[model samples]
Target: MAGELNGKIAAVTGGASGIGLASVESMLSAGAQVVIVDRDAIALKAICDRYGDAAIPLVIDLLDPVDCATLIPKILELCGQLDILHCNAGSYVGGDLIENDTSAIDRMMNLNVNVVMKNVHDVLPHMIERGSGDIIVTSSLAAHFPTPWEPVYASSKWAINCFVQTVRRQVFKHGIRVGSISPGPVITALLSDWPPEKLQEARDSGSLLETSEVAEVVMFMLTRPRGMTIRDVVMMPTNFDL
Candidate 1:
């Protein structure tokens, strides 16, 4: 499995930590030159330093429209050609929708939804020209289920789920494979939004997934034969309930 990604170049958003960081390590181990894209300048620098040139760091606020528009362009500028793109950066807003402010809701939608679309749109041209590329968006299990607690967050992911499938239909003929990974309750900072008791219960019950576990799924999706597109992978802990 090692060196499976040799000669490939990848760009992962939110690559400084959590699922993104773990995926970065997985891709690097498989022999891909990964560009760690995140807004955290310090963390990005640290990660790049650890991996040397194999890990290129790009620090920019994705929430900013100007920065978001320029993400793929910048990655292409740095890597020449982007063989893979992992849209893993996202924000969480759990609990009743009424309890959150409009600003929080807006921010979540912009990053979790808008920015993802923009990045995909921007990268499509390059991929189409080359006639080959892989795109993986990080969706959530909430997108498939109607969970009332986090309506807003779930809605954002649902939008992404739709987007991924629809885009796949349109782009497959171009030799571009598009898909999403819908993971349930991974142990990341995103869990901070869950109720304390619920989080503790999941941890105690072995129902929470690790970031690396999710990253391994990303690796699997990437390494599949080009003719076979894994449309969506929904992974969860064996003990996970609802």
Candidate 2:
């Protein structure tokens, strides 16, 4: 296992499944103290059993500001340091711009942008105080690719991309590196929610990017030398028409 991250403390939101799960494994293997935060209690319990005590699993609703506040002290208690915050939780509600439902739009904006902003707000002060930290956020290829059919998801990602980029400029001098990773179609159970008929078509048409592919880039960003920062990483499968 790679140990480049040894002795580092890495906090990962949405760490229970998908790319988050891959990151948890990679971070632990790289010898970082890993904290997996998610709202899935059963999955959280399973992760604790699977990764042992060093892989601390916390049940959290990212939409809650108090949850983020609670997270900081826990990290201090468990690892005595906070060197990385990997914000990788995201959700999608499909609809064309003209046909989108109001509630769906709200859910996408609230869960994606609002929660991320809150977590960043809560962590930035601590990172700035330490004068050394890395913030890795999950942006999306859709942010750049025009997808009016998925307007809310694409727009939310676009907002996050700008937010992280701005933070990179503001905080890099303060010893914090802020960056984003935008991956192609990541193969997760989340995609399986589509109808079985559409699922095969989606894969055949171009939607087979694996979660590990994106997780690898995330590791690349967080594990680089202290003085360097990977400003932005945007990638999609060649076959992906998007």
Candidate 3:
């Protein structure tokens, strides 16, 4: 198990921070070289420095379909082959939709929904030709339940959930595994944007999870025996109310 991923190369979007950063660290420790893709050039460089030769940092905007299309080819250029694609980049907007501007909604949908579709579309052909690969996405508990506070965010996650399920079947014939991890209220910068009262409530109730917890699930999905493919995993703090 020490070199479970000895020959694999992985690309993690949003890999500069939070759950994405945690997954990057775990994959590297599991004996895989990883490409850290994010818009934060500074953080990407810092992570690449920390991991040295194990990490290749690519600074790119996930919201741009054009940029998303370029990711796998760029990754292949850097690492030679890509065996895993972790689409962990996403954005959130809270409060009632009435108060959310149309442009804000568009940005949210573009990042949370469009980017995932584009990444998968662009990566599928290469994966299919190779006859094997894995695609893991970061979904959310919000996808399973309607949350009034972050309606748009929840809807976006729902879209990803559907995408994972449908695409998993499509790629199974090609030996590709597609799945998602849905975590509730993780203590990441993503949660830093929550309304002040909601953040306080989650903190007071000890219902916030750490980034590493979700990262563990990512590794779990990757390391499963080839005969067994975990389709979805939902992770939440023990005390999480919803």
Candidate 4:
């Protein structure tokens, strides 16, 4: 039998590292042609070199609305048509609101919240026109809880959660599926920024999640049959408190 995603085209944002990198590898293994989008030009070029024709690298910042608008069209120009979009690029800022600098909050919101909105806005029209597509946003478990340790990061996720649900409802008739994966405390560079005490606590408690696990979930969501849609997947390590 053929690979489930053979002949499909996918675009993965923040595809240079961590969960984004893992997701890109998974999609390629499943026989999809993918365009890896990221601001890390060096890393993106390396991936393209490693994967050769299976990967196309686009090095551009997603913060600009114009860049987001051009992304899908550029992906289509490369691979003909788009079948999947993984909005997996995001940043995390951990600390109390008072202690955190205003600049940090602004950057976090712009990256985690605004960028996501722009990408979705740019991609949705094409998906609607084609009447088929799958959109998977990399959400956080914080979206479902009051994560006092990372309130701004939590707020960004909360906004994404709402966007995914509302957009799913709006586009269901157009044969597009929009959903999010809410994973708890993934072991990525993002976690490196956590307070040392909090990191130690999670390490002692064995609550840290691996990036590949999240990639597997993204694969699962994308490979489902046409008529089925898994709206939200809430994933957490067994010992995590929230």
Candidate 5:
């Protein structure tokens, strides 16, 4: 029997590890062929090893708009048609906004918003033709709440959530569904910068949402029929985060 997502094609960014990697696994398990894009060599290869032909791994730096533009066409060529895009690649490279270096702020803006907009612009034409496709982005809770210690990161995420909301309004008329997943801290390689003591404390708080939990939100959006759309989903850890 064919899987629920049999014959579908998905492209995911920051897909080599963390929430991105988890989404890759989730999509594949649902029977969709996937193309994984990330800057990491080792993790990308591991993804390919397990899924083999069903998964294609590409090394990409999202901050580079050229990669975003180029990858858009490459995805269509590989899949013959594109059905879904999961723009889940992002990083936390900021301190407080006032003392933050200008370069770091620029990088965060480019990676978090500019690159994603470029990719969306490039892929939207084809998706428009079909008038049916899935677009899922991973935002953050900091998008809505305050992050005094990481103002730039907070601003970046808030902007991302705004982008998703605005795009949802623009695309829904065309039958293209757009949604974002806002996940509270979950264990992942992306959190490597946190000191061990701080990390343990967060985990012990008993409210961390696992990668699978976030994946379920993505699944819900995709599995929804044409009759409905999920604009944004904010997932909280039961213990600490609201």
Candidate 6:
């Protein structure tokens, strides 16, 4: 499995930390040259340095529609051929809906939903031209369940679920594979928004998933044969309850 992705090129958004970082590491170990995309230049530089030539850093704030539009083209320019694109950059907004400001909601939705869609849209023409490619969007378990505590965040992922499915249908004929990985409560900065008591409870119950665990699922989705597309993978900690 170490060289399963040898000769492939991958671009992962939010690759500076957390799930994105873990996925980048996984891809590198599999022998793929990965482009690490993130807004933090320092983190990008550090990661790229640690991984040497296999990890390429691209720093851009994906929240800017103008910048997000440039992502695919930039990756194409850098890698020549982008075999995989993991839209893992996202933001979290938890707590009662009324407690969140409109600006925060807009930011979360833009990063979680809009950016994923835009990146996928921009990459399609290239992948379709090649007649083969893999696209994986990082979704969340909230997308499939009604979460009152984080209604806005859940709504954003729900939109992602629909988007991934629809695009998968449209691109299957082009030899492109589209899918999403939905994991629950991964231990990342995203959990900082959770109520302190709830966070503690999840910790006590061993209901938190590590970033590496989710990255393994991402790898699983990416490595499957071209003939079979994994539509979506929903994973959560065994102790995690809705």
Best by lDDT: 1
TM-score of every prediction relative to native: 0.98, 0.92, 0.96, 0.94, 0.94, 0.97
Worst 10 residues of 4 by lDDT: 63-72
Tens-digit per-residue lDDT, 114-230, candidate 5: 877777777888999998898998888888788777788888899888888898889888889988888877787757777898788888877667888888788888988887998
Colliding pairs, model 2? none
Tens-digit per-residue lDDT, 22-141, candidate 1: 999999999999999999999999999899999999987999999888898898888899999999999998887778999999999999999999999999999999999999999999
Q: In terms of TM-score, how similar is model 6 to the real structure?
A: 0.97
Query: Residues 1-242, candidate 6, lDDT per residue (tens digit)?
Result: 59999999999999999999999999999999999999999999999889999999999999988888889899889989999999999998888888899999999999999899889989999999999999999999999999988899999999999999999999999999999999998999888867799999999999999999998988888888889899999999999875
Runs with alpha carbons beyond 4 Å of true place in candidate 5: none
lDDT, residue 20, model 2: 89
The digit string of per-residue lDDT tens for model 2 on 188-213 reads: 86575567887777678776677888
Best by TM-score: 1
Provide the lowest-lDDT 10-residue window in model 1.
Answer: 233-242
lDDT of 4 at 106: 86
- Between candidates 2 and 3, the one scoring higher on lDDT is 3
Pitting candidate 1 against candidate 2, the one with the higher TM-score is: 1
Candidate 4 per-residue lDDT over residues 1-242, each given as its tens digit = 23879989999999999999999999999999899999999999899999999899997788776776788788878887888999999988878888888888888888888888888888888888899999999999999998988888899999989989998999989999999999998888998877799898898888988888998898888888889998999999999864
Cα-based lDDT for every prediction? 0.94, 0.83, 0.90, 0.89, 0.84, 0.93
Off by over 4 Å in 6: none
- Model 2 CA lDDT for position 113: 87
Q: Which scores better on TM-score, 4 or 5?
A: 4
